[model samples]
Target: MIRSINVSSATLRHGIIHSPFRLVTKPSNGLRFCRVRPLSRPSRPSIILARLYSDEKSPKENIKPTELAKKVLQEAAKRENIYTIPNMLTFGRLLASPVIGYLVVTHQTSWALAVFGLSCVTDLLDGYIARKYNMQTVVGSVIDPMADKTLMMTLATCLAVSGDIPLYIATLILGRDFLLFLSALYYRYISLPPPKTFTRYWDFSLPSAEVRPTTISKYNTFLQMIYLGSSLVFPVLSQSITIETAQSIGMALKGLEYVVATTTILSGLSYVFSKDAVKILSKPNGKP
Candidate 1:
């Protein structure tokens, strides 16, 4: 005779199927089972579990392009423009150039001199900042000197036109710049190395055999700055000093101009006599 067997509900829920051919009964264990039913519908627990896992997996696939762009922009915004105190000062001088010109033209001598002096301070501070902070950039190298030239040229032109300086002085300074500019152009066109000015300062060492600035060129730039500063200051200072004293100052400024002109000519001659410069100049027209 066959006897009924008992099975736990947990086993049925877990989808463990048993064959109905035999049964063993033990009254001490409290387990029961009804007639086995074939599963007509899919297991609800398994379906729910699959849906939970699929939902968890979708977010990685759903990340859109817009989200990536936002992330990139956020990273970019965190980056900083390099800053140095000296460079900031130099930038201030650049901004002050027009103010100085306006004061000089309006006969505000004291104010113009003050502004010019501030610009000089900025120029000095900028170099210090660059060296101290190690925040130099290619843009700074070009822009710094360009700003200096602008201020110097503007002051020189104003002084020359106003009869404070001789026209020849202005012409000489500007002419040297022009010649150097043309040489730079020639070098660029021939694919030769660029001019070895301050921009190339990093490439050479002390006592190195590189084609570098002649001492005369350095002296020329120094005198140019001196004359520029003096010319800017004289008109303002003249208001306090007697005519003869002012004339003496003017004579001294003119002497500086002559020195600058002579040094400039000598520097240009040195570059012209350089073997590399001669080779570059000898290149055929239309040759790249």
Candidate 2:
């Protein structure tokens, strides 16, 4: 019977050329003959794999990967302008944080409360203006949360030092914020565009990454604000208000402190586990 045998691995010592496999096409007189041919595959560098694909003829024709990333980032930058009334108000609130802390530390309770109230008003005003006027920018996204955290840290530190808030709770709050700050720095360094330099890294106007605060994190910030604000305002109110009202309000705040502690732990953990907390802005392929 005429038949064909496949010889996948047959070492031929006499030949110098190496093929993947030898195929025996025919058998005759109890002997098999096969042909050996090298299979050639065009080698493509892995670095070339990062390609921006849009139109069928787009990336394959003219533009390179790094150039396309710059184009996309530039387009993003155009859409997000840093100058806006809301962003200005947020910057003002950030600046007021240290003043409030200083006032608290110096035992100027009335002055601290007044300035803190103004800062809170600006915080609310900035966010409302940003959403209503469509003045959202990448820098705003970063600095808004930064301002809030700065206020919280300043108040927590000042209150803890003055023996107003529990030292342990202050420690937890500062520790979590410090961890998040380090993480943000690391992400900014890695996600930054090419030719990353000292100047470019510090320039917040350059849009590179966006942080979408989680739902729990939002609640945590609100709770922290209430906790810190009450810590400042309650004593001043206690002197003027009735004894019964002071006792009741003090009880309510005592309970809130525990709630804030729990939420602080949860919000910090949420950042670690949540997938979309921080998003790196880039093309679908070849992340820049």
Candidate 3:
């Protein structure tokens, strides 16, 4: 191997990185000082720029650009836009859940029906507004379904206590929600980065997992809402109708009860079997 301290003007004009040279602290080309200002990313002619600064260790080796990009994409979790019209509506429904349940339990049939109707309206409007106005958010995704579940559970429990809906159906609904809640807790803990404190676990801003409701689950929610809603309406209508018509409505409701029960079971199983139901956002090792 030949080593030369050639630093000629002509050699520089052509290219200064051709021949073998010893690993000196500085080039012998009289250009002893090198000021490597950080560059965003250089355009084409990548080889020339890299060779000119070969003295500076290759950023590729120390800082893998591919790995950096992948990390960015992985950590690119959506910021929680907790304040939004849709989320506000969802919150409203959540508040109304207890109100509606209390009204039902207290035998305020008319008021309960009114509040439940309002809750359903918000439920429909929130989703539509989120989609049309591009207000879809990560928190919205979470709270929307959460509000629905809360409302459904409250209503189911209330109606069962009032003997409007079957105990078996209520039991099924509560069981499914209980299992899902436990699953959610497990996923959240596993996905949360290290140093997980009580505060961090509850922080929606640092979302650790995503819950994707399955198709059957969605339909089940809709059916359950209808069943619960009809239960509220039944008391008011049964007052205005004849005994024969009341009996017929009761039979219809019984059949609906069977349908809702089947859907609830299927929906619960769907979450268990489906691959995309609940996704863990980060690893236990704190890598996103």
**What are the Cα lDDT values of the candidates?**
0.59, 0.78, 0.78
* Model 3 whole-model lDDT (C-alpha atoms): 0.78
* Model 1 misplaced regions, further than 4 Å: 1-86, 181-214, 268-288
- Candidate 3 lDDT over residue span 1-288, tens digit each: 223342322113234343322332444555554322222343323334334334333534453445444444444443466788988999999999999989999999989989999999999999999999999876677778889999999999999999888899999999999888888888888888987899988878777788999999999999998889998898899999999999999998889999999999999999899999987877778865
lDDT of 2 by residue, 1-288 (tens): 434433321122222222234343566788866555444432222112222223212323655557655655544543356889988998998899999999999999989999988988998999899899898888888889989899899999999999889999999999999999999898788777766789978887776778889999999999999999898888788998999999999899899999999999999999999999998874323255
Q: State the lDDT at 63 in candidate 3.
A: 36
Off by over 4 Å in 2: 1-80, 283-288
Candidate 3's TM-score: 0.72
Instruction: Determine the backbone clash count of candidate 1.
Output: 1
Best by TM-score: 3
lDDT of 2 at 58: 38
TM-score of each: 0.53, 0.71, 0.72
RMSD of 3: 11.6
Global Cα lDDT for candidate 2? 0.78
Badly placed stretches (over 4 Å) of model 3 are 1-78
> What's the best-to-worst order under TM-score?
3, 2, 1
